[model samples]
Target: MPNIQFFALAESVCKKLNLPPIPFPVRKGRDEIIFNPQGVALDLLLDELEQYLIEKPEEKIFYKDAFSRLAAIEGIRLGEEGFHDHAAHYFELGLALDPANLALRSNYALSLQSAGRKEEAMRQYRFLLQQPVISGQCLVLIPAARLFLDCGDPVTAHQIVKHCASFMPVDNEFWDLFAEARQRCGIKRWMAPRQKQQEIMRQATAPDYKSAPTGKKKNFCPACGNRLKPGARFCGGCGHAL
Candidate 1:
């Protein structure tokens, strides 16, 4: 109904994995295929594909797109099942085959974050931000801002959202994070019209700001904004180890 190509592929995968074929019932209309989410054993198929990829790494370049799709699906399934580390592993494998796949990259970064691998998550987000297509996507911007805020970089979070504002209307989530960033950066939102107007005027008339004095910079957790105790190897707030 809805393109039975993957169905055949799934059957082949089952054979390769030495598993029984999925008994997909024959349906009358295309709508049945569209509505049935569990019509296939996607997770099992993906597991088989992962094993196949592992044993036949040379075939990855030839079957990159298929492998990437399977990996993405499996990663999402594992993440939904509360297996974040496994999810991250699959996502990483997917990204390795198709580095330009932003969706896979986003999912992988999210999995890394969920798995308490904050530094690695930040690195992936930063890499995504540098990509022209990804930099403009709100999906990437929102999470990157959140990560930056959590990592004690509200200034960076604010800057990222502010840049996004020029291209797209800010959503509620963006505004919420923006408010948090402002608060954390020692700024307050004005409720009064007069105060708001005065603040705007001040900003318009203020002289150019000078750089702060150079000193030893404080270290903060990449996972949470808690100040890192000297020589500490983990985040106290989120339990993310360095």
Candidate 2:
């Protein structure tokens, strides 16, 4: 359910490319993201927080709430640990803080789908579709339709894309998305060079760009030439501020 940007960044990570990585939604409640975390560390933080929430149980957790931000941060870390259940826990916590939060809802839905609750995932997507004041972020819709197709209802999936094609913007990015949706719907002809370009763009902005070295000795941030290893005010040599 994350925006196209999130998936695109994930795809980039999957392909080991470096560019503008997709971002996890950061607008969730304070209980969602844990920034500048120190001695608590990643491993024990979630456990401790879970216990804390249990004993104190407050009302209306949202992005502004400290606990909610921490929960979001830990949730992302849990996801990286391949602990899908824990990941869902934090995502839900994030949603609890901000129910109408498209980012959390979308991501939680994807986690459900990935965890093999296909029907539940589709139900979430349907709910997202029914939002009358939705943003122009068609990324969530396109991917969900593909999921439906893979779940053995090409007819419904086809309808999904056909109805959404109008919502799609006029650009190569969306054209590629349509191409992919059509291909998922059994329109083999949509698999063309444009779609290939889209795939390339997806690869470009994936997560963990440094997982595989980019054949460069120095891992300077290409954007600002900032030396990445920390403890420096700027690039000691390039003067790019850290």
- Index of the highest-TM-score prediction: 1
Model 1 residue 75 lDDT? 91
Q: Quote model 2's TM-score.
A: 0.47
Could you give candidate 2's per-residue lDDT for residues 181-231 as a string of tens digits?
576667776644566788899888877645654665666756566567755
Model 1 segments more than 4 A misplaced: 1-7, 10-40, 167-170, 186-242
Model 2, poorest ten-residue lDDT window?
Answer: 1-10
Tell me the spans in candidate 2 whose CA falls farther than 4 Å from its real position.
1-50, 58-64, 133-135, 163-242
Q: How well is each residue in 1-242 modelled by candidate 1, as lDDT tens digits?
A: 23322234366655664444433222234334433566655555455555555666786766677667768878988999999999999899888889988899999998888898989999998888788877678877878889889998888888787787676453656666766777888787623334457889999999988987899999999877899899998888888998
Give Cα-based local distance difference scores for all models: 0.73, 0.59
**Error of model 2, residue 101, in angstroms:** 2.6
Candidate 2 local Cα displacement, residue 234, angstroms: 99
Strongest candidate by lDDT: 1
Task: Give the Cα error of residue 53 in candidate 2, in Å.
Answer: 4.0
Q: Against the hidden reference, what TM-scores do the models get?
A: 0.58, 0.47
Task: Return the lDDT, model 1, position 118.
Answer: 85
